[model samples]
Target: MIGFMKKDIAMIKNNLKVLGVLVAFYLIMGLFGEIDMSFILPFMSIAIMISTFSYDELNNWNSYAATFPNGRKNSVKARYLTTVLIILIMTVITIILSLFISYTLNKSIDLEMTFLNMLAMIFGTALVQSFMYPIIFKFGVEKGRIMILVVIFGTVIVGGLFSSVVDLSKILNFLGVFENHWPLVLIVSSIAILYISYLISLRFQLKKEF
Candidate 1:
């Protein structure tokens, strides 16, 4: 399993030059007023996972991996685990940066609330990936890529529209009912979503063929 993960990481690192360019550009724009840094984190997380899955799908790396001792299940597990690990690390780093920026700028950002919102965004993105990655694994990247884009873009558009019409800011007031318990609720809900997504991905991977 470690070997499988190493190979995937190696593939990601080998493309570091390209990845670095993207990350740097994102950081610059985020640091500037080009876009809210908070908005970039989940998108970047989703991008990394998609890139990993897309790379495997396009290269048929799993087919080669299956010839090893651990079999296809390990290959799938390695990919899922690696993707989750990367997302968590990236999310943490993004949170720290965003907080630092908010503090320096003296913006009225609530660190805890922002953190929860970021987690919610990541969870939402993962939910989409959980459903798509298996299908991508089963089919080839060429076809799967189209569907993934549609779902992601469609979701974003709908979400933007919904937010425009309905003020989600009311969540803070609604959540005020819990008062001191809000943190616990946020943490528990985030954990539940993470676990559910992982289970879905695992089940999907188990059913997938090389």
Candidate 2:
């Protein structure tokens, strides 16, 4: 497992030059411009991880990896572990950056609320990958990428119709009940989603030909 993670990390390191340039440029804009910078953390992680999957496919890495000891299981485990680590690290980095941006924009840091928002962001990001990884595992990246777009389109259509018919404000008002414990809720929900996603991905990988 550790070796698998190391391989993935090495893959990330291979792209550090390009990643650094984009991250630096985005941070500069967030620091000086009027952009809401919270999106960068999840956006960068997802984009990079998806590209890593593309690399694996291009190299036919999985077929070779399956020749190793428990490789199929470990590969899925390592990917999820590495992804969680990336997101957690990025969340910390974003919070630190938020300190400066918040102070710059408002002359104050609402530490509590900022932390809560970060929790929410993690849950949201993890939720997306939970839907994404299983598809990518069952179908190669090329087809999975198209499936993802379709899923996103369907979600937007459903969301639009639901919003048009449902009373969202009242729903939100009802959900205010979880405001105090939302952090715990987010943490538990994220764990459950990741666990379920890992199981589904593992199943697909175990059955996958390559």
Candidate 3:
């Protein structure tokens, strides 16, 4: 398991400059723009996760990995693990920045709302990955790239429809039920989504021919 994780980390290390640029851009946006940093973290994390697939496909890494014991399973697991790690790291960074912004700008940051948004993004990212990885595992990266755009636009359209159709008061009331427990709910739901995604990816990978 550790080796699999290290393999993913090694892949990411090669893209450190890209990651740095992304973080820098987001930091600038968070500091200057009206947008919340939490909103962007999940999208950034997903993009990074997808790029790993691109790297793997480019280098024929998955085909090479198939020769190792339990390689396919571990590769899928590594991708999921790497994504979770990235989300956790981003959450920490978001918290620190929220604090810094509050202190420097003399504005009060709503820590609870920030946390809730972070949790929502984490769950949203997991849900997106859940739908994405299985397709990539079965279809390879080239087709998977097209699916990525489909997933993104599909999500946006669905979200727009949901907002337009749903009652704002009812939604707020539903959220009110969670009140203090929203974080726990988000954590549990996100973990469940990720586990299901892992199982789906594993099934696809086991049947996939490199």
Candidate 4:
């Protein structure tokens, strides 16, 4: 698992230039845009992490990895671990950038709210990846890429409709009820979702023929 994680880290490092460009673009937008878009940072970070599947597929890495003992399960575990690490790193960066932006704009910083929002964004992104990885494992990357886009756009449309149809005040009130325990709730829910995703990916990998 450690070796697999190192491979993922190296893959991410190789793509640093592309990720740097994305970060710069989003930072500029957050600095000048009316609304805070720092959440997009973690969102894009997950997208980048998922793209490793495409890279591995293109290089036939999965077939090669199959020769190693327990490679498929380790690969899935590594991807999940990589996603968690990226989320943590990007969340911290988002917080710092949000604080800097607020300070520059002479706005009040709501650290608790900002942190909660970041966690929500990370959770949302991870949920998407959880659904995505199983498909990629089952179908290979080319078809999986199309499915990923479908999943992403479907999520956006569903989220937009849900938000529009839901009562905002009720949602706020529900959140208010759990205000003191929100952090614990978020952490537990995120972990549970990621573990379920890992299990799904592992099952897919086990059944896949490399």
Candidate 5:
């Protein structure tokens, strides 16, 4: 399990130059401009991980992995573990940078909103991975990429139609009843989604021929 995780981290390490460039750009934007560039790292880490899926497919890593004992299961589990760690590390870095930016600009840190933003980022990144990994595992990355886009577009259309007929404000108001517990709710739900997504991907990979 640790070996598999190291493998993924090793892949990311090879991309350090790109990651450094992104961090440099993020610092420049956040320090000199008013936009909240803190969201960049968390979201960009997801994109990097997705590209790693492409590398895995191209190298037929899963097929080779299946020859090892419990390789498929460990591979999927380790990938998710590595991905979550990356997201968390990126989020933490962003939070610290956000603090510097805020304090530099206003002489104070909005710790509450900063934490809230990080929580939202964690949930959003986790949600995207949960929705993406199963498809990538089942269909391979290339086709799954297109299918994911289609699914997202269809979902947006359906959600738009639903919102047109439904009073979403009421739903928001009801949810606001648990305002103080929003962080806990999001953290729990994100973990649930990631666990479920891992299960689904494991099921697909275990039975797959390659």
Candidate 6:
């Protein structure tokens, strides 16, 4: 298991060079003006995860993965674990870089909102990944890419409709159950979604021959 995990970790890290280029680009933006560094991290993290999926598909990694002792389901789990690890490492790096830049430039920074923003980012990214993973597992990345775009567009359309008809702030008030503990709420919700996605991925992988 350790050997498999190390291989997966190495593969994940190798796949991150594109993300390194993106991070450098964002750092250049930071130098020019104020950019929402928090927002950039989640976007870059998602891009990295998607690129990993792309690489796995292109190389028929799962086919090779099935030859392992634990079979494809464990391999799927390892991939998901690697995705979470990469996102977390990138998030930490982004936060540290953002703080350094903010302080060096004497920019006004709202540290209080950092945890709240991270909560939202983690939940949002997990939601996107939950929707993407099942499609990728079943359809392969080429078709899954199209499904991913559809999901994004559909989400935007749904969000627009909600915005038009619902006062989001008011709705937040209506959902007063989590008023004071929104971070915990988001954390719990993200865990539940992740659990569901994991189950779905397992099912899809089980159905797959290789």
lDDT of each: 0.68, 0.87, 0.81, 0.83, 0.89, 0.78
lDDT of 3 by residue, 1-210 (tens): 678888778877876787677667776776788776656656777777788888888999888988889888898988898989987886777677677777877888787787788888888888887788888887887998788788789989999999999888898888799887878988998999889988988998988877
Quote the positional error of residue 155 for candidate 2 in Å. Answer: 3.0
- In the predicted model 2, the residue pairs found to clash are none
Most lDDT-accurate candidate: 5
The segments of candidate 2 whose C-alpha lies over 4 angstroms from its true place after superposition are 101-106, 160-170
lDDT of model 4 at position 210: 69
Candidate 6, residues 29-127, lDDT tens digits: the string is 776765665677775667767776777788988888888787776877876776677667766877787787788777877775777887788888888
Record all residue pairs in model 4 with backbone atoms less than 3 Å apart, i.e. clashing: none
Residue-level error in angstroms, candidate 4, position 40: 1.4
Q: By how many angstroms RMSD does model 6 differ from the true structure?
A: 2.7
Order candidates by TM-score, high to low: 5, 2, 6, 4, 3, 1
Ranking 2 against 5 by TM-score, winner: 5
Cand. 5 TM to true fold: 0.95
lDDT of 4 at 78: 88
Q: Each model's TM-score, in the order given?
A: 0.69, 0.89, 0.83, 0.83, 0.95, 0.84
Instruction: List model 2 lDDT by residue over 1-210, tens digit each.
Output: 999999989898877787677667767887788777677776677877888899999999999999999999999999999889888977887887778666776757778888888998899889888889999998989999898899899999999999999999999999899878999999999999999999999999999985
Q: Which stretches of candidate 6 lie over 4 Å from their true place?
A: 152-170
- The per-residue C-alpha lDDT of model 6 at residue 171 equals 82
lDDT of 6: 0.78
Query: Stretches of candidate 3 above 4 Å error?
Result: 148-180
lDDT of 2 at 159: 98
Candidate 4 Cα errors over 4 Å, as ranges = 148-179
Which residue runs of candidate 5 sit more than 4 Å off their true CA positions?
none
lDDT of 4 by residue, 40-112 (tens): 7788776688678878988999888878888888988988999899888888888888887788878898887
| Count: clashes, candidate 6 | 0
